[model samples]
Target: MKFISWNVNGLRAVVKKDFAEIFQKLDADFFCIQETKMQEGQLKLDLPGYRQYFNYAERKGYSGTAIFAKDEPLTVSYGIQAPEFDHEGRAITLEYPNFYLVTSYVPNSGAKLKRLDFRMGWDKAFHAYLNQLDSHKPVILCGDLNVAHHEIDLKNPQSNHHNAGFTDEERQSFTKLLDQGFMDTFRHFYPDKEDIYSWWSYRFHSRDRNAGWRIDYFVTSKRLADHISDSKILTDIFGSDHCPVELLTNTL
Candidate 1:
């Protein structure tokens, strides 16, 4: 099975910019999206052979998530089961007989780290949510987790060490999450691959210079490591600041 995750930034906007073409071309079994930035009844997509599930934020035009899957899930759930953090529509989980697929648009810490405290709380809640799901079955987690786990994950790491996504607090939280029986699939496959990233800043010609961060990911339960065949950053295809990250598995 093939899974793809992309932070489109805004679903409505991306639809006007080659999103249809890109979606058709990828043809993934499961396509997860982050930062949909739209509320209910805002846009309707015509996608045949795929079941669409959306968790829209209570606030219009803000954070949201969706998943389009070729196969119907046994059950679908929204949010991380924490009331305070569920308002943003940042998470969606699809439960299958053998595994659960979860995607999230993790909250950013903000310009001057104003929301750093909230982000830290979210990290703990989200990690606990994943562990709970994993206790039932293996998990296939993806989307824009909003952190560059290591120096190798982003360009100009030295200069951006204290930035929102590169902050020590954020990085350590991610590390703790992984330590709890999860695997960052991309690094598992390419431990030393350098200069590759999934997201770029719109300013300063960041994408052109390849000065970007590998914030999007396909993380899975450590037990599912052998089932994963490949994990890749689809840097060549773009309709948004963040590119799609893919996971290919042997019929998981």
Candidate 2:
């Protein structure tokens, strides 16, 4: 099975910019999206073979998520089960016979870390939510997690150490989440691969210089490691600031 996750920034905007072509070309079994930035009834997509599931934010044109899967899930769920944090439509989960697939658009810490407290709270709740799901079955987690887990994850780590995504608090929270029996699939496959990233800043020609951060990811339960064939950053394909991250696995 193949899984792809991309933070399109805004689904409506991306549809106008080669998204249809790219979506048809990739043809993933499961395609997860983050930051859809649209509410209900805003846009309708014509995807024939895929079942579309969306969790739209209460606030229009803000944070949201969606999943398009070729196979119908046994059950579908939205949010992380925490009322305070569920308003943003930040997550969606699909249950299959073998495992649960979850995609999330984690909240950013914000400029000057104004939202760091809320982000920290979210990290805690989200991790608990994943662990609860993991107890039932292994999890295939993906989307723009919004943190560069290690120094190797970003281009200018030294300069951005205290930035929202690179902060010690955020990194440590991610580490703690992984420590609870999850695997960061890309780093698991390429521990030493360098200068590869999924997201770039629009300013300062960041994408052209390859000045970016590997914030998007495909994470799975530690036990699913053997089932995964490869995890990759699809840097060449572009319709948004963040590229798609992929996971290929043997049939579970």
Candidate 3:
């Protein structure tokens, strides 16, 4: 099966950018999106052969997530474990026959690190939530996790040391997640690859220079490591500052 994840940045805006055409071409069995930045009734996608699910933020024009799958899931859930965190609509999980597919647009720590404490609290709760899911079945977690897990995951790591997303504390939270039994499928295959990234800064021609952060990911439970046939970062696709990341697996 094939799965694709993209932080569209704004679903309404990307529709005009022909995101639908690219989505048709990718033809993933399952597709997930983040940072939709819109609420219900603002936009609609008529994707045939797919059951669509969306979780919109309580506030208008803000963080949100959605999932489209050819096969309907047994159950679908929105947001995280905490009611307070659920207000922003940053997550969605689809419970399928064999596994749970989770797509998230993790809260950013903010430019001044003002939100760092909140984000750290989120990481702890999020990890615990994933662990609970792992106990039931394998998990395919994908989307803009909002953290560059290591120096290898980004360019100019030294310069970004104190940056919100690249800060040591955020990176260590990601490490703790992996240490708890999740595998970052992309790095598992292309550990040495560099300068390849998903989210680029809107300033200074960052995308053109490839000065970006690898905040997007396709991760799975360690037990499903061997099932990851391929993981890809589609740098060519354009719409948002972020591009799509894909995962292909026969076991899905």
TM-score of each: 0.99, 0.99, 0.98
lDDT of 3 at 191: 88
lDDT of 2: 0.96
Off by over 4 Å in 3: none
Query: Pairing residues by index, what is the TM-score of model 3?
Result: 0.98
Candidate 2 lDDT, 1-252, residue by residue in tens? 899999999999999999999999998999999999998988999999999999999998999999999998999999999999999999999999999999999999999999999999999999999999999999999999999999999999999999999999999999998999999999999999999999999999999999999999999999999999999999999989999999999998
For model 2, give the 10-residue run with minimal summed lDDT: 39-48
lDDT of 3 by residue, 57-89 (tens): 999999999999999899999887788688999
* Backbone collisions counted per model: 0, 0, 0
- CA displacement after TM-score superposition, residue 214 of candidate 3 (Å): 0.4
Distance from true location, Cα of 110 in model 2, Å: 0.3
